[model samples]
Target chain A: MKFLAEYRDPELAKQYLQEIKNTVTQPWSIMEVCGGQTHSLVKNGIIDMLPKEVTMIHGPGCPVCVTPLHLIDKAIHLALQENVILCSFGDMLRVPGSSKNLLEAKAEGGDVRILYSPLEAVQIAEANPSKEVVFFAVGFETTAPANALSVINAYRKGLKNYSILASHVLVPPAIECVMEDVDSHIDGFLAAGHVCTIMGNFEYYPLVEKYKVPIVVTGFEPLDVLQGILMVVRQLEAHKAEVENQYARIVKEEGNLEAQKMIFEVFEITDRLWRGMEIIPMSGYQVKEKYADFDATKKFKIEIEEAEENPECIAGEIMKGIKKPIECPEFGKKCKPTNPLGAPMVSSEGACAAYFHYSGLVEEY
Target chain B: MASKTKPVKMQLQCPMPKLDFDVITLGHGSGGVLTNKLLDSGVFDLLSNEVLDERHDGAFIEMNGKLAFSTDSFLVSPIFFPGGNIGELAVNGTVNDLAMCGAIPKYLSLSFIIEEGLKMTEFWEILTSIKFACEKAGVQVVTGDTKVVEKGKGDKIFINTSGIGTIHPKANINKNNIKIGDKIIVSGNIASHGMAIMSVREGLEFDSEIISDTTNLNTTIINLIEQFGANIHLLTDPTRGGVATVLKEIAMATEIGIDIFQKYLPIETQVDSACELLGLDPLYVANEGLFISFVEASIADDYLKYLQSDANGANAKLIGSVVNEHPKQVIMESAIGGKRVVSMLPGEQLPRIC
Candidate 1:
């Protein structure tokens, strides 16, 4: 409780909110790059408590939301295919592929199974020698290491039946892509502290200098978020760009070397599609060439086709901070959480899902 | 949707799991096939009773003419998540239970089992969260007690909250009232609060963000009851367990089967993806800020309109309804051309995910 209780202190939250209120002199938009932080901001009514001049928009930190339709389609296809055992965490099952989702396939007698970790899939493969078992690896840097380590263990044991359809994404490339866009609205960033705990905070220093905006790497706690916001706002108010870290207790400047190594060994940066946004350079990671034999897409010789974003979904625009999920005419109509039109609504990190699940009356916002 | 043409392989055989193990493993606690077995053989045997055997998260004790009593314990890892903390969770969880039973949750008693040396700051924050939670739900924490344990003896803090409320007499509601052709409606998207809790706790990131759908729904329920009145056959807040669990409960309560259209099942894109990645069934995952209502088909339209007219029910969808069959089962029509049995979660998919 000591580690966590302090972060929720109302007096502390009020003190930080007051300081943030006093610091902001002009209108500024600061994007919290982690979906978890976004949830806290909305659920705690933090945004409403803040000064009107400081606008906080959600960012593309949701890994599931950014995953492409084809990847989902591939997972369902793998799950439904005879003799194939598809494995993934709970989140991917409801994500709509082009035609169906893992949940749908599961309903139709597909061999789709939920796992607590990628390593569990390896154990399943080890236990069964006859069937090909594929772990549909998903998420950002925080989970990449675990997925990577699973691959390493599979290779170490020479498990022929084990492989992964890697769909890992990076945060820095995404930030850069946003800043490079000419019509961008992101003025600063609340860097994901958990991701940085594994991948380090140094990456943002370069972005701060390049974009001339504040970048605060902070934990997901409310106090952490509020403090991070205050730091970023002060930087913006002073017309100065800097990189700050409020999650110093857990997040070091260098990050976890062991995790980075595992990730590097298993995956290599490559082109990949994001649900709501266009494909950016080196934003996603593919299974390393050396580990291709353990790659589900490769081992199965599966042909993956990139499908266009759902025409009805403005998820990409929403993810880019250019549009809101409600902006789409079909938001609550044709496109809903039950029948999501795009990835943003499906992925946990998506802005639209955040709005749909946690937002209060659509009218006040 | 494009399909992936790959060298799909069969799932490795389950290694013919042993029928006997020394003690319960985490796998047994998982909401898979094995977990169901444990419930059938072990857990239910000890706890089963005429009333307590209902297998609900919290038991409902009707206090004759006025009061409704319910108690719940908090056991979420990382005690603090994206939205509300344990203190907030403790208050709303008990309050929501009273609301579910057609009662206006009005007062709460808080008890805390804390680890020793717990930071004063953190404890203060928890109290603040409870204070705000009370304010939001329009409930009062009349009194409370706190106890501390040695370090490593506890998971930071565990909250036990008991609440009481007054039920509305004119608005009698029960799942048994559901009949064939009754319409099923969800208050909003599912899995947001559940997935958000998992992602933040597990350090999993998505293309979007996840926030806990933690809120007081007494007002929303009251709104529906006012508009639809007795037409609301059943009302349940699917927390700790998702929609699937509640549906199964209703099926048993009504002695009739249920069939929900998968397409009409409301959930966010990210929550869906998060469920998939975690190898969890969103139907079985926990939800903090969502509900499902079963109403007579004749009044379904009016209720639907009333739900949409309100902000909380803005994303409400007409999912499915009751069928003529034994009430012990739940059946969902797949988006694909097939029907599948949707049952109770049996075990916890994500431990301490509440």
Candidate 2:
């Protein structure tokens, strides 16, 4: 609580809000490049407190939101197998696949477990020698090292029953995709602080240089987010497109090298399919050939034909900051958390879910 | 929720008595020698009172005034947790439900559906706690039944407690009674019980030890009714769906608006940290030992001060108030002066990938 309480201090947040109000001379659209940041902004009501000149755009930073549909079908298929035990993060259980979600499969008697760490899945494989354990490894760079380490831990223990169905994504490629969009009006970005804590601020420098947009590494706390927005506004006002770290306490320029090494050791960059979005080249991580024995897709010889997203869901547009969740035709009516039209509504960190959960009914209340 | 009490491991007052079997078997449910032996040895005597000692098929008791009856089944995995176990939880759950109805809990009927392989020692621990909890609430467990399921058919143990209580004479608790400008007062901290369970849950263990806040609130509720009377418009506990869901449900039902302040919401530092670590909202997390009261604005301060003096109400705070501005909506103003809707929980709050 030491570092956390201070970051949530209301007085400090007020100072940063005033600073942003004074720094901005004209209207600016700034996107926070993480679903966590978007969640904080909405949950803490920071979006309303910000000066009218600033508009916060949500990004496609939720791994659960962007995990391809076909992969979910495969994970479900694997879960239902006779000797397979599927383990996944709790959020992944609700995202609908082509037919049903993981929770539905579990209700139908599939042996599925919700675990907080991938290493626990490895331990499960160790405990049950006969049952095949497949971990639904999912997340961005913040989770890449841990997912990779699970495989490393499994291999060291010679766990023949352990494998990972990975859907790891990178933040930089997603940022570039947003910039390449013809209709995108994002002027600055508050990069994900936790992601930056792992991979560092070096990755954002090139994005700033290429798009001439100021990128501020932002923390998820209320005060940290407010400060991050102020920093971005200051850079935009001075016409300085550079990478700045507002969460300097946790993130460094080079990042955790050991974690980066662990990630590259077990995984390789691949052309991954993002849900509702087009395939971004070299944007996702796949298990390496050396870890092929620990890859569920390769081990089980499972093949899933490409599935399609719901035609009505504007998740692709929403992820690119082209449209808001409320702009979609079936936001709260047809697409609800109980019956989701897309992964964005199912995941807690999804832009659609965040907006649906935190944004009030009356706009001015 | 604030940490007014630490998790204390309860000690069994009486040791497990000698039994024919070390572990329960299917024969224990057959109502034969095994069943009688299991109960006669320790269960009946430990919870013995005039009503329970009668050994009748059902309890025959006398009631005077308007009564409240409530029943709840407990099926929490990890039957035992840091501060308490399923035994006390079952007792407190039904007791608090009756308390929320502005009733003084009096009699309880207990039942257990236990797995065949459950150890005798564990069952004794559970039964002992139930006896202690019943005594503390001044309620008697009159009649009961026990059934044993096959090993895989059930969890280690499941308890169901049904209670009947006499309504307080001065109480006027109803959702319709809530009026605009009514102040919302939270009894104590939030999210402690849920986090305590999560701390010991498989694969989600954290370094810090959080105790569950699972205690009876009948005494506090009865005292409030005795003092404030009808000024306390409504009384309800924020149990399963947490504070946010309960308030939202009330607002929607009564067609009244609620505005809560984040700064005033009472939560312990450790519980807040755990919620943040899991990417979970404490508002949606479950609480067992807390209640929300709707009182007239004039007596809100005095009510809070008086309630805060009680053991279970020390961490109590006036969180929000009823309004006519936005009917059917619950909005919370953040510590930083921003606002968002405190909506009903869509589903169980799940941990995030990050």
Strongest candidate by TM-score: 2
Candidate 2 chain B minimal-lDDT segment of 10 residues: B1-10
Residue pairs that clash (backbone atoms under 3 angstroms), model 2: B1-B189, B1-B190, B1-B266, B1-B267, B1-B268
Off by over 4 Å in 2: A362-365, B1-11
Number of the predicted model whose DockQ against the real structure is largest: 2
lDDT of 1 at A180: 82
For candidate 2, lDDT tens digit of each residue in A7-47? 88888888888888889999999999898898889988999
Candidate 2: what is its chain A TM-score?
0.98
Question: What does candidate 1's lDDT look like per residue over B14-55, in tens digits?
Answer: 122224443333344355765566445433432234343554
| Local distance difference test, each candidate | 0.74, 0.90
Docking class of 1: incorrect
Model 1 agreement with the true structure over A233-317: per-residue lDDT tens digits: 9989898888888889999889999999999988888987776687888888899889988988877756767666667777666
On lDDT, the leading prediction is 2
Which docking band does candidate 2 fall into?
Answer: medium
**Candidate 1 lDDT for residue A282:** 83
- Model 1's DockQ? 0.03
Error of 1 at B244 (Å): 14
